[model samples]
Target: MEIKEAIALIHAEGLQAGTWADLGCGEGLFSVALAHLLPPGSTILAIDQQPVKPLPYSIPAGISVMRQQADFSLTNFQLPALQGIVMANSLHYITDKPNLIKRLAQSLTDDGTFIIVEYETTQANPWVPYPITLQALTELFREAGFTNTIKLGERNSVYRSGKMYAARISR
Candidate 1:
């Protein structure tokens, strides 16, 4: 699913973020949306290992989309406390999640929540490492310090794909 739809889903669940970071943001769709949807004086930090191109949409004054072309490794990131950290459709690409999640928890503000929206990879080859089960993902995050796990919704009933999931991790 697109980042806009993901952000829309977050909004439907009544999560209003004053400061949003599109962590591992590829092109900045959700970052742009957060900039637009958030209340006045809010900011959206669109960070990625690659720089996002100039968006088709204009960035509002309050939004600060920092295009960081640095790596996403935990050792590389020096995250300051942020309101919301979004891991949208990019979890599988991350090599080491446990350490990353711990860093994320530490980087979050007192009232912050980490949001992870990922694709439902079907169970297939056991020896392969591409797809991981929902339970596995939850356990990984829980082990990393996330407590609340919930299945948010299905992306759509197509190709028997797994449902979209979101978890809230308190700092």
Candidate 2:
């Protein structure tokens, strides 16, 4: 997706300038979008299992991104308490969503946000092995103790799999 589209998908009001993590960041597409909206002095930790390219866009001043190669689904991986987490096109790869969500919630500070961009479909292909729709996403996060959720935006998928939706969840 384009940077403007990415930003529109996950942007929300009242985002504080602080540390955020993009799990399964790939090449930091969504990370760069988040950086655009974040206030100066924010930092992003972009984690992916494979090597990632340097983010393509020019990031905002005072914002930094640290890339790390790691499996974000692994329970043993450590992260500092963060202001937010972005799981753009990444959560579906995991088979155990509940456990991963619970573990990730622990990595967030109180009032932390979780921004998710996902295909709103039940059918899964090789690329999205365990997909969850927006309804399922709300239930999943609620079950994991997240208290609030709001749909941010939606777009037709370029891959033609289905419509894509973005949601913000918070505790």
Candidate 3:
């Protein structure tokens, strides 16, 4: 999806002004988009295991973007209290899914939201280690203590010609 469209989808999920995180933020596409969408004084933690270089483009003033390199699978990795977290096309990489979800839940505030954009296929490949359908994702999040889960948007996956969905889960 386009960056503007993705930002709109996130906004539709009732995102509030506060700290947010873009876990496994590759190239900072959504991270930069979110920085633009969020209100002034909001902070976005753009994290990935790989080092992130400075953006070629400019970011507006009053929005803090902290890029970090850390393996999220390790329990030692720290995440600040967040109002929302976006895991766009990233969850499939982690071998320990439940543990990561639990840790993400612990990092969120009471009213925090977890937004996920993933493929809607059950097939797994080398690139997609743990492909999960939307139903499975909702059940996983539900088991992790999120009471509400909503579908924000969907689109055709260019790589596999399957479907990709964006979901919002809340405590």
Q: Tell me the spans in candidate 3 whose CA falls farther than 4 Å from its real position.
A: 57-61
- The lDDT per prediction is 0.64, 0.92, 0.83
lDDT by residue (tens digit), candidate 3, 60-91: 78988988887777888888789989898999
Tell me the tens digit of each residue's lDDT in model 1 across 10-102: 453555556667787777766675666566666667778775677665777755666656565657677666777877656666657777777
Against the true structure, whose TM-score is highest? 2
The TM-score that candidate 2 achieves is 0.97
Separate clash counts for every candidate = 0, 0, 0
Clashing pairs in 1: none
Error of 1 at 6 (Å): 3.5
Question: Given candidate 3, what's the lDDT at residue 26?
Answer: 81
**Model 1 Cα displacement at 107 (Å)?**
0.5
